[model samples]
Target chain A: MAERALEIRSESHTYPIYIAAGLRHQTADILKGLGKSTFSAVLIVTDETVGPLYAEEVAASFADEQPLYICTLAAGEQSKSMETYYELMTFALNCHLDRNSVIVALGGGVVGDAAGFAAATYMRGIDYVQMPTTLLAHDSSVGGKTGINHPLGKNLIGAFHPPAAVIYDTETLYTLPEKEWRSGLAEVIKHGWIQDPELLKVIKDQWLDLSAVPVDVLNDTIRQSIQVKAEIVQLDEREAGIRAFLNFGHTLGHAIEAEAGYGTLTHGEAVAIGMDFAMKLSGKVLGSSLDSEAYNEEMIRLGYDLTIPASCEPETLLAHMKRDKKAAEQKVRFVLLQEAGVPLVRPVEDDTILDLLKEEMTI
Target chain B: MAERALEIRSESHTYPIYIAAGLRHQTADILKGLGKSTFSAVLIVTDETVGPLYAEEVAASFADEQPLYICTLAAGEQSKSMETYYELMTFALNCHLDRNSVIVALGGGVVGDAAGFAAATYMRGIDYVQMPTTLLAHDSSVGGKTGINHPLGKNLIGAFHPPAAVIYDTETLYTLPEKEWRSGLAEVIKHGWIQDPELLKVIKDQWLDLSAVPVDVLNDTIRQSIQVKAEIVQLDEREAGIRAFLNFGHTLGHAIEAEAGYGTLTHGEAVAIGMDFAMKLSGKVLGSSLDSEAYNEEMIRLGYDLTIPASCEPETLLAHMKRDKKAAEQKVRFVLLQEAGVPLVRPVEDDTILDLLKEEMTI
Candidate 1:
């Protein structure tokens, strides 16, 4: 029964993360294990892309068990809007889903986020299971953070609502493009940078290859990444203290996403660049002796474009950083890493940040 | 400082409920007491009705302590909507109100609910203070329940987020119409029915008069009502168990509102009628020997119109009841009162409920 799975025991909630191949077909059996949730209905919140591929298979898994509804959203970051969230709620309510209804977030980070947020707020939160189909979701699927993007800021409107369980099927990863896989790998790199050195070795073994990963290797890699995420989350579920370390690269990454415009760079690509800048910043501020060239080389080899577009003004990026959702008191705070597993969230002056941005981002 | 105030010690959170007159002018002083919230920015979310009367006073209370912004939504239930929620998030984000910002929900239940919901989600939940102006807010102000209505359901989307504090200024209630006072009273009676009998006696003394109550009596009554609410909320912050009792009348009341059309009857009046049906059901189902005449007399003398309108179909109301957000497994369960301080939630057979609905609702 213990088929490559680990349980995340957060401060407030404890749930399992199943890392295996073709586990999506076992949705019903897995949910029956949730002692408290006697859900009589299931709403599979999926996107046009993931829905077409796996929604039917997952829905068929619930045959005669209970009523199951599938809601297909437009695929992309745009679907994580209030309009989409409202539509999903209307659709759920229209289908007569009651309190015992469970939402199945079936897709990557975008689908997980939007669907998870819907679950967070629907009837003041209903039980939801994360059926993440991408590697980026390995990061988001563990943490209870769920939300949609506001036009002014991404994730400005959200909640810290955890899923009941995460059922990840590595088989689904086979269909993803190499760039998508590379984009997801950046977060795995982040998990390694923040917590596990063994994960770094795993990535190093693959070198620059993103074409394909053997099933067993992929499952193990996902299990390791989720373990790092689960440990951090268990320590600080609400981002009160150590959880801020999870944002190691997000501070500058979010600003770049804003300055360069979202959809211009995959989230992992920007975060990879952000981690590089944070690394250098750590060396300057915390006096950490780390090999900058090797770190840069590893990211580049992993197919991440760390080049900051010239159009992204240092001042604008700095402004975006200050306005970051994680920035308390409008201070530009970055999660600076001294080394693997040791991180600090501290405010850096605008001049210091601008100096680094100009030096690194302007080619 | 033994003022007329009580603290709510909920399972997840403990916050103060200050019940007094002229507390609006004391916003800055009250907020300084929160230990961990080093908020440098304040967003006072009020409505047109209340903002025009007190926004400037509350904003000035900040007094160079920090930056404060006021966003006034349109006054009414319609304001408790996704559009308004989105607009408020946009406004707050545009003003650069980051994670350290505090939101002041300053108005009646609508304003408190909408503003509190924004606080619950903005930057994935920030600190919020409830400055309830209406008597009805005494019920909503305590329970950490924050939400906006969807097109399909009332409060279809929300969160169980507690406030930093609830500052109830009864001086503001003086401006409220008598109808609003009576409307708020319905919840006071609900609290009394489920928890405290003393609160019921307090209301009995002021029978048939919506005009005015002395400041001392008003303050004490609100304190008692809030005390009952606090105790119940402390037991179950989320409606996992005992918190369901708080929905004694709300189960059918919500359906009546939906079927009879919202805004036709105040929330309190609909609830009062729902309580009557629940009381009668409790007698028949639980064999509780309660005087129906005395209960009916109290509501009538309290100036509540208990008529359930001829247009409401029993089957339609039954359907709505089954679809209630609180309903489990699509079963129409109700918080039926055996007597004061003894409430039991049980699912009534559709025929049983239909018979009662036909007998009582069909005038």
Candidate 2:
């Protein structure tokens, strides 16, 4: 098969999200072309786990003339705190990194969020590259949604700072645990449900997939997923309008994650459960044609642990979701599916939501 | 005399800078019109001294239903620190301020810079009203150049955050110290030097006895000053190209300010001294036709302490100017006048600059 290089172009910026099997080895050549020589130093921001795995290989790629610094944080959702953000910024400042310097974010969503935000605010922003090492990063890394979590809200304190480039090395995915892969797939599934019905069919067909998928097919899927996010973001840079549609399952998912205390549930895992709950509610209340049996079978085949454990009470989850920044005046605003590829948001009443929870509890 | 309002309009935004005797009383009505608010809470951000003096009067004019909260900082350049920024933002977050929240910056340039930057970053930015109480703010407050000082540089970290409304109450200028009045006149002189040769004659004629000028004339002068500034800003939102003309005296002024430590030499005083030096250099090397003696006599008559003291050596000032972000590499760039109203930038050789300084010192 011929190797295909895909390009994602926007009105203000255009860069390629290179997705290939062994792209990590060619990082030096790729980055040298992207204006890295102007900088005197390069700082690598990674997680505790990922730092040991790929930090050495990535560090060696930078030219021997430029000094390098590696900053690593704990590997969890808790790492996206203000304390961590301040520490990372202090690290960069102490290193005497100037405006010409760049930060390399090399981890999952948490690392990307914190590091990207650090880059955004450090010296009023600087160039940073997204070296996404997780499946969820395929969404977070490409969209420039870099921010730290606020006590009042998740991803509340952030700016629309686009990355200089995104290098998605698929080889890194081999080290991800099954739970992490399942988490990443939830977002991929979300992109399909919101914008592309064909994506849903493809995923549904590959529900019980063998590990025999070609690199080109995986690359195409990542590109299409990115296009869905990029097109929405381009229309609404600040999430004032159309971009809010991207919060399909996140309205409930975030509430559950916050209530469960962040690290207790992986983002994708919570999102997977939220998508199921949203789909069920859609079928009962919003007249969605999604078949419950087919949906459950596909989720099971994809290895989602969708059991709503008794510890997370439906009332508590509902309350947290209502307190979501997206909610106005303590009302849960659900971005429901009118059909595959047709997403709409409306205020859902507490009573109906409670009844929906009661109906889903039987599962 | 009819109280004429000085209307200053920029692209995407418009507001009035009312300069008249006893116009502080007119704040309520003007704010209502500019804000389009019949009833909304106003977040008044002022310094420790300014808040006690005018926060009450400003708050009293609003409708009884309109709530007001004061966010106050110390009244100096030191208050523009990151700690004050965090405290002010935390106050707003605790106050339950929303997107509709209006921030009223009710102090001088330092207060405006700090408060305006706080407003710019809070909730990714909120609308602000500039009720400038100092003459220096006539220039800083109008141009939308809101930022705080870093230890390494002045105004290095900031964004182009234009205020929603600017109410320049000239009545407040009456309380300004004579030194401050001289300080602000430096910027007023700068605007004329950059864009209007006729304005220089106006300044040269009546600047010494500005204390006796009628409030209407003062209003007209301010209007002209703001028009020159607004026209320049309208063309260049960010300091990309032509806007650099605004830095005619700023390069030397900032270096002087930094060398003296920010608060010691009030911004205008340093710029006053810097402008005298620049004009002298312009006449020496660039063949400027303006008689250098006339420049010094006008400034002296206006109560300016134009001498660059022996303590702030020309060598130190030159080094600080070289560290300016505007400087490409280590070379010092100056905005010199080819003729009055025709400002142009060129690199001055270090030897010629040293020669000019040595000559000025001997005089």
lDDT of 2: 0.75
Model 1 per-residue lDDT tens digits across residues B106-157: 9999998999899999888888999999999999988899998877667878
* Winning candidate number (TM-score): 1
| Model 2 residue A4 CA deviation in Å | 9.8
What does candidate 2's lDDT look like per residue over A105-140, in tens digits? 999888888888778666666778888888788999
Q: How many backbone collisions does model 2 have? A: 0
Clashing pairs in 2: none
Model 2, range B312-334, lDDT digits (tens) per residue? 77787777776534334556788
Q: Which residues of candidate 1, in runs, are more than 4 Å off?
A: A2-4, A206-208, A310-332, A349-363, B1-4, B206-208, B307-332, B349-363
The digit string of per-residue lDDT tens for model 1 on A1-363 reads: 425389888646788888888888888788887776568689999998999999999887776767789999999999999889888998888877776789999999999999999899988888899999988888888888899987765677899888898999889988998888878888888888888878888888853367577887788888888888888888887777888888888888878877787778888888988888999999888988777789888877777778887778888887777654443455577888778767888877778888988888656
